[model samples]
Target: MLTGTVKWFNNPKGYGFIQAQEGTENQDVLIHYSVIEMDGFKTLKAGQTVSFDVGQGPKGLIATKVLPDNGQGAKVDNTEVLEKDSSLA
Candidate 1:
């Protein structure tokens, strides 16, 4: 798995970009909410450290699976994730 930090994530959009760790060729990675390996809310925060695998997406490099690193980064309420999704529709 590759380690990286999230650049930013839009909860309502359910997608974000991750900046890969230094020395990696794929610096920018696309991450979707579905790839987040969490039980409740599938989302990531800006600057959050994460471990993920790389895969080819329809557009570009995408995170096949994302796991938050030791629960680090900003905290978000569970309702936020759910609320954002519903708001989009």
Candidate 2:
């Protein structure tokens, strides 16, 4: 997952961009409003930490399944967890 802060989201426009987290690449990711949790759209600000999946789009990588990754948030990097979540996590 890639992390970034919300650059700006024009709800009516149905899209937004995220400035990649510090120490990350110098590029921003595209985010479609629908990919995020509905309730978070309002509370999310210009600099909130979020994790997202990278999808290859016609334009480029698009952010999907965006969510607040708490400081202690563990990445989905463990095979055990992925297997469990896929089956019973």
Candidate 3:
């Protein structure tokens, strides 16, 4: 999960771009307007807290599933263990 601010949105065209908040290689996220608010376009705006998935599109990193983060930050806790003997340490 990554946090970013909406740089710009094209309601008519049905797509937008977001400037990553921090700690990401790709700074911009490509978003399809269909992923925008269903009620109306007003639901989104620049500098809004948006959480999305970074996917590899035809070009590069594109924001696939997007949603408004209600203050609580996204959780990313995937753990992997490597087995080793004490003597190796």
Candidate 4:
């Protein structure tokens, strides 16, 4: 898996780009919300660090199975908040 920081994301459109942290040769990878493996609405925030698998798309490189880094916790969805609240009791 390649590690990178989210360059930008369009929450409504469900697409974003990740800037690879490896080297200058590595270009930004396209990330679609569908490819994200989250339980609920998957959305990425700018500057968030993430790890993902690299794949070749028709246009260019793309990211798959994207996950937030250890230091950066995963974004919370409504379901998760409810689950947490229920667990408290």
Candidate 5:
């Protein structure tokens, strides 16, 4: 698994891009909602840290088995995330 930060995510669009950590081959990886492993509403927020596996998609690099970093690396509170985005709530 690779660690990275979410550059941006569109809740309604159900897609986003992750900025890979320094020294990674891919600077950005596409992340789709389907790959998120969260139990509730699966969504990511900008600046959020995460770990995931990479795979080749039809378009290009994609993130799979995405897991949110709930430890020290994570900055945003999951509840705040849901509250901030009313659409996802």
Candidate 6:
């Protein structure tokens, strides 16, 4: 697995981009929310550190089997939830 930081994620769209750390040729890898292996909140946040495997998709490079570097389950912030709700309202 390679280490990287999430560049950005669109929760509603269910996709994101991960900027891989040094040593990987594919810097920006596409990551889908479905591939993220988190317990509760299967979502990614920008600036969050993560480890993942590179895979070839129909379009281009993509991040697969992603996990948080901290090894703990991802926690969904209440503020984020509220923001999402407010946006919808």
State candidate 1's TM-score: 0.76
- Can you give the lDDT of residue 40 in candidate 1? 67
Report the error of model 4 at residue 25, Å. 2.2
1-89, model 2: which lDDT tens digit per residue?
Answer: 77788787665587777787643466678887677754533334456678777666787668767775563321233587577789753
User: Which run of 10 residues does model 6 get worst, by summed lDDT?
Assistant: 68-77
What's the distance in Å from true for residue 55, model 3? 0.1
Per-residue lDDT for 1-89 in model 6, tens only?
Answer: 88899998988898999899864685589998888986776887889999998888888779878997776535666897798899788
Flag the better candidate by lDDT, 5 or 6: 6
- Which one wins by TM-score: 5 or 6? 6
lDDT of the structure predicted as candidate 4:
0.81
Q: Report how far residue 19 has shifted in candidate 5, in Å.
A: 0.8
Question: Per-residue alpha-carbon lDDT of model 1 for 1-89, expressed as tens digits?
Answer: 98999999998899999999953585589988888887766778898899989887777789888999865334676687698899789
Query: Residue 30 lDDT in model 2?
Result: 84
How many backbone collisions does model 6 have? Answer: 0
- Judging by lDDT, tell me the better candidate of 3 and 4: 4
What is the Å distance of residue 76 in model 4 from its true position? 7.0
- Report the Cα RMSD per candidate: 5.0, 12.6, 16.0, 6.1, 5.4, 3.6
Span of ten consecutive residues with least summed lDDT in model 3:
73-82
Where does model 5 exceed 4 Å of error? 22-24, 71-89
Question: lDDT (0-100) at residue 58 of candidate 5?
Answer: 86
The local distance difference test score of each candidate is 0.83, 0.65, 0.65, 0.81, 0.81, 0.83
- Ten-residue segment with the worst summed lDDT in candidate 1? 70-79
Lowest-lDDT window of 10 residues in candidate 4? 68-77
Q: Per-residue CA lDDT of candidate 4, range 9-85, in tens?
A: 98879898999998426788999988886666678888989889988889888886798765333465578769889
- Cα lDDT for residue 2, candidate 3: 77
lDDT of 5 by residue, 1-89 (tens): 88899999988799999998853585689999899877667888899999989888887789877998873332345697677799865
For every model shown, what is its TM-score relative to the native structure? 0.76, 0.59, 0.63, 0.74, 0.74, 0.77
Question: Model 4 misses residue 19 by how many Å?
Answer: 0.1
Q: Between 4 and 5, whose lDDT is larger?
A: 5
